[model samples]
Target: MNLLEEFKKNPGFVYRIGTDYYYIGKWICKPCTDEAVTDCHAMYEMCIQAKEPANAALYFQKLRAYSEFALDIPYNPAKILQYQTALVEALSDADIQSLTDQLRHFHDQAS
Candidate 1:
């Protein structure tokens, strides 16, 4: 199912920011453009804007999936590979970004 649909399974958690819908514990939908708000961009804008440890961890989880997608791109106009490396380093065991809580229930479910 789509990300929005997935979020629908659990109500009252999805956060709507401008035209996009950020599933607090899931992902951020692409900006609306007169079309349906579909396709959960693996790397969300919130991920870039995350600050708090709990929220960062949530966004970080999404970043992990994004990092994988980044490595699969063919043309690579978005420099996703660089982003992938940076995220990996930041979320590494060395605590480069200093991740503390796992963000399991910070915003949404453990997933």
Candidate 2:
């Protein structure tokens, strides 16, 4: 099933910003996209914009899933590797740009 179909099957929580809905499972129709990656990226954007330490920590924790999710490599290395590969490729060009901008702003603030 596609992301939208998966979302329809299970109605998860929604986060809204103005008119935009950041609900990964529901609105996004991208067939190749992984739901976890989309959800993490969405939370990352919101956390960066909010400029709160707590949210920053949350985003960091979310990012750490890339490592945590791979901990079962001893049993099924190939499956985990494929998942990691897909997760790494899940970010779109716009997502990369937004992440870059957020990092730049953070650096500027630090300096």
Candidate 3:
């Protein structure tokens, strides 16, 4: 029997691809959930640990995308805040200061 047939017969089969695990029919496997979460957390951590602001921002963007897909929900304030916190943490001190300054300038200009 083919893999599809096997999956239909027993849909519990999970396959690992690279660092991520996928279910038989492109579904998120139960066993992979924890691993996926851990991987995402690690990615976020790496972004925080990055020396370069650009690299950290790139990783934060990727992390946001991944979190969105994984969460599969509408715009939830709590979730958005969580991701924002992570992204903020990923920024270097200099970058954070610059961003804060820019935000303040923009706010002052708008007001």
Candidate 4:
């Protein structure tokens, strides 16, 4: 099967294809997108497994922390921009797109 198909089955495997994006295999992106996706999914799962409100609160704390670090918004804007710029500079178009997709997912899942 094609990489797109694979990604459709499992979004955690998003990868680059020339200038395009495809979700297919194992790739852990700590920059902004994939890492965010992974963390968001983890949070969702934790929420699902939460036996008490305290556990869910812990997951929200973690989610907020991850998002803050990744987006770099509300704490030293210059530093956050630098961090995000470095990642964007190093990424291919495909990576950026995939990251964007994952980021959107992260946003939805986070809330």
List the candidates' TM-scores in order.
Answer: 0.22, 0.35, 0.33, 0.37
lDDT of 1 by residue, 1-111 (tens): 122233323322223333343322222222223222223332233443454446545554554454333333244423533442443343445332222222223233334
Better of 3 and 4 by TM-score: 4
List the global CA lDDT of all models: 0.33, 0.42, 0.40, 0.43
Order of the predicted models by TM-score, top scorer first: 4, 2, 3, 1
Give stretches of model 3 more than 4 Å off: 1-73
Better candidate number, 1 or 2, judged by lDDT: 2
Which portions of model 2 miss their true places by more than 4 Å? 1-32, 67-99, 102-111
Model 1's C-alpha root-mean-square deviation from the true structure amounts to 13.3
Q: Residue-wise lDDT of candidate 3 within 29-80, one digit each (tens)?
A: 2224556555654554455456455554554455434433554334354543
Q: Residue 36's C-alpha lDDT in candidate 2?
A: 70
The digit string of per-residue lDDT tens for model 2 on 42-69 reads 7766776787767756655554443244
In terms of TM-score, how similar is model 4 to the real structure?
A: 0.37
- By summed lDDT, the worst window of 10 consecutive residues in model 4 runs over 22-31
Q: Is candidate 1 or candidate 3 better by lDDT?
A: 3
Decide which is better by lDDT, 3 or 4.
4
Quick one: best lDDT, which candidate? 4
Report RMSD (Å) for each prediction in the order shown: 13.3, 12.2, 18.0, 11.6
**Residue pairs in candidate 3 whose N, alpha carbon or C atoms collide under 3 angstroms:** none
For candidate 1, the per-residue lDDT at 1 reads: 18
